[model samples]
Target: MKTIASCVQEIIISSPFLEEGLSREIINFSALAKDLNKPISNMLRKPVKNGAIMMALRRYQQPLNLENSNRLKTTFKALGDITVRSNLSDFTFQNSKTLIRSHSQILEKISANSQIFYAFTRGILESNIIISSSEKESITNAFKNETLIGSKDKLSAISIYLPNGNSEIAGLYYQIFKRLAWENITLYEVVSTTNEFTIVVEDDLVDKAFSVIKRLKD
Candidate 1:
């Protein structure tokens, strides 16, 4: 059986945006009580009042601490060299030795003319190759399979170089994603390496995204 305190704590921890409300002690008690009453009724055999839920919330609240806040801000500041690249294209290839050969061939041709970013997961080899509109035909022809090309001028990439000692920190990516999600920014794709993280978004949102990241430093 779940107590009101445990239930309220679970809700706050699971929701990144709601965590702030908990910190500020401004969460809606009525709404929370209503949400939990049905499920908790099965366990406790009765409905609980908003006042009881509110009391449990206050009693079990986990306030944000200065150490964690300082660590996060430091990590953000250490993220040096935030760069945005435009006029990008994306290609997703099925994972195979043939795909690797095709990728190499395409890379040779576009090495001098464009910037290439690629990643390999379990079954897909995804590439976001930034090239000029005039060079698109030459690049596309190099691949044997159908390649998915994105809007020529609409896509943009934002790359962040993480500071040393912060790349391995837990919840680092969550902090970045949470800010973007809160602003309703749609991420086209995400690429990451040991010390760098990159996200592709519409060109229009580049500035807004950059601003959101910079605010983490403050």
Candidate 2:
């Protein structure tokens, strides 16, 4: 089995679509191998560690089809290779009667409960804060520490994971959001960590948002 790097090199070489130029030459493994004076055989001998090479091939084979694949590339290029998993914990308020307010007001109230808030930048809204006991502490703590360590307003946050700090994939979030915004769905807060992204929305819009995301995902 050939390694991923080598496979990528070969794929680039095999693709006539890459064009004839320095940029094309740079991505081509044979050229790169010669330029760096490395053994082409050595590079091709190793199987791809992850699925990056295969991903690249998929991209060249079909441009517009791999909506998710393009997302993976854009994100991987920006954040590096990362593992994304949906967080299972739910958010719920102690009282179901908490008044809905503007983003600033919501942040202020949530901030009073804790210091560290869950934040995310992009992605779809799945549901309203379902405040189960398991997530209360984190929620409460975020409220207490309302002051997020950023130049912008850091009231409440949506915690997100970034496998390797890749921001290019952030565009995928933008893509999903464009349609939502068109439909008048407003996003309140965003926070990202290392692995996943989360978006907070108004309680009233939770169900609608979830449906949109479900439709897009499906």
Please state the error at residue 74 of candidate 2 in Å.
Answer: 10
Candidate 1 lDDT over 94-153, as tens digits, reads 455556676677667756753454333334454445444455575567664745533344
What is the lDDT of every predicted structure here?
Answer: 0.69, 0.43
TM-score of model number 1: 0.80
The segments of candidate 2 whose C-alpha lies over 4 angstroms from its true place after superposition are 1-170
Give the per-residue lDDT of model 2 (tens digit) for 1-218.
Answer: 66554455564565433422324334554444343333333576533323454344334432344766676555534432222223223333222122232223545655656532333221232223423233455454553433222222212223234455445444566555654674677876544445666665555565666555544433
What number of backbone clashes does candidate 2 have, counting pairs of residues 3 or more apart or in separate chains? 47
